[model samples]
Target: MSVIGQAEGIEHGTVRGYKQHRYRQIPACDACKKALRDDRAAARRGERPERAKPQRTSRRKAAEELDAATEATPVLLPVPPPPQLPDRPEIGVPIEGADLEIGDVIVFLGNHHRIDRFEPYTGSLRAELGEGTRVACAGTWGMTVGPTSTVRILPRPRRDAR
Candidate 1:
């Protein structure tokens, strides 16, 4: 029997005690199914389906245009050099035996710090340094400052430095 359709005038058959319907009803091949799907899709889209066109661009033309634009633009002025940083003042504070008060500025290990609070009982001083400042000493938080710690008093920043 033909696998694709009913053989001759035969509409159905029985094989192994099982009834076999026509190919259209019982089974359709891959090609038939794909064609039916494409027809339906085209009907829904209201047009014959066509393959997509490849998108293409000319790299050489684009590069030439960019080069032309770069050449056409004029350089009006040379860029100025960056301004120099003002000289910092020399200030020091020896944590070992130095009197400290709130709002006092000191430099520690080349970084500037301001004493924000002092605990007489614990002999701990809380100081705030410039944001992003890095220091080598540890325990700068609570009970951190010790007599052995030497801090330099930072010079006031020039008005321009602000």
Candidate 2:
């Protein structure tokens, strides 16, 4: 009975067209109904192939129930934080002409920073991590633990080409 299936100039009289109408939950037009009746009559007289019955399902009801359940119960899952980069076991190695230094790349507290130089102080080493941040301590040689952060350097890291 919907006006959508009753376009003035559109043809909806074929079996294919009627099936499409049923798919959209639209009522078949009078022309399509007459075509179906004539086809059945011909099949009874053995004049044509029998028409196939359209498949029926309760998908609409299930979809409606799903919509209602989602509306009644909101999703309360927490969003996980972004992944952090794993720390490097050996930040640097001792080159023939250089003191123990850091690698080209260093990951700290889930962040990466470049280290081109070293600033040593007594029992520990200091590396100016970024613009205004000066974090002290290198691998296992000694670690500097403060109220804010901790840095450690491995005593004997393999000499690698960094």
Candidate 3:
């Protein structure tokens, strides 16, 4: 008998089969075998048979509605500019506990000079105020000019000076 008729034959009690039989060993018809295989594949892939998705509105109609809604909305005003920053001081420099370097400009005795060199061993700095005037200022340690001296290192002159 054909395999397709085996299930019918078993159901009708007309076929004599072995007493010990594995269900997997039983041959199935084409359609039943296809369904069993599909179910097993879905299980192995960690998925279930999905149902058909619901229909959605047309893309053109949805886009037209969105455009109409946006056009009907009011136009928003531009954001205001941020607050202005405060102006900084013209002249201010800290002299205490500072490290002096070559090319540093210092205001001393109503004159400005570029530092030519620093003598740490003698605690002095050599600078040129202008032509024909190069002097050694004492107490250069920690960049302190002197107890009475108001000398300070200027980062740069005022922009108006240029």
Candidate 4:
């Protein structure tokens, strides 16, 4: 495919031509993309290589030019400070793993379990779901290994996650 297309005399090898292609819903060619990239690279370096250059400059002349350029800079206005945002309350409440009280509903095995008997010292709890089904947890955590826990001692912790 021709990278520099000449369908409508749009000059498709340049950055301006690339924008024209986009405005007309046409995919820009590789040459146009390369041209755009080169243009941006030149802009970052503050240079226009395609434009005519003075060809030579002495150190003193270059210093004078630099001083002139600095003097030509526009005056900057003072910017106001950012607006202060209103203070917000913290999101979800933090759950203490072993500090859960009896009759407190807890989520275990993705099910709601109301604690029946809880041992504060052992961090153990017995939760009952219904009339007969009961879950005796050895620790406050649903799954524990090396002081790491997978569950929080809260009623429907999984629900809050969703």
The top-ranked prediction according to lDDT is: 4
Query: Tens-digit lDDT track for model 2 on 24-127?
Result: 43445667756766766886999874344455549998798779878887754444423433323354211211222455334345443445455443333334
Ranking, TM-score, top scorer first: 4, 2, 3, 1
Per-residue lDDT for 13 in model 3?
18
Q: Give candidate 1's TM-score.
A: 0.23
Better of 3 and 4 by lDDT: 4
Alpha-carbon error at 112 in model 3, in Å?
A: 0.7
lDDT of 2 at 20: 49
Worst 10 residues of 2 by lDDT: 92-101
Off by over 4 Å in 3: 1-92, 121-151, 156-162
* Clash pairs, model 3 backbone: none
lDDT of each: 0.41, 0.44, 0.41, 0.47
Clashes of each: 7, 7, 0, 0
In TM-score terms, candidate 4 sits at: 0.26
- Which pairs clash inside model 1? 91-152, 91-153, 92-152, 92-153, 93-151, 96-147, 107-152
Better of 3 and 4 by TM-score: 4
How far out, in Å, is residue 61 in model 4?
A: 28
Candidate 1: segments with Cα more than 4 A from true spot? 1-96, 120-143, 146-149, 155-162
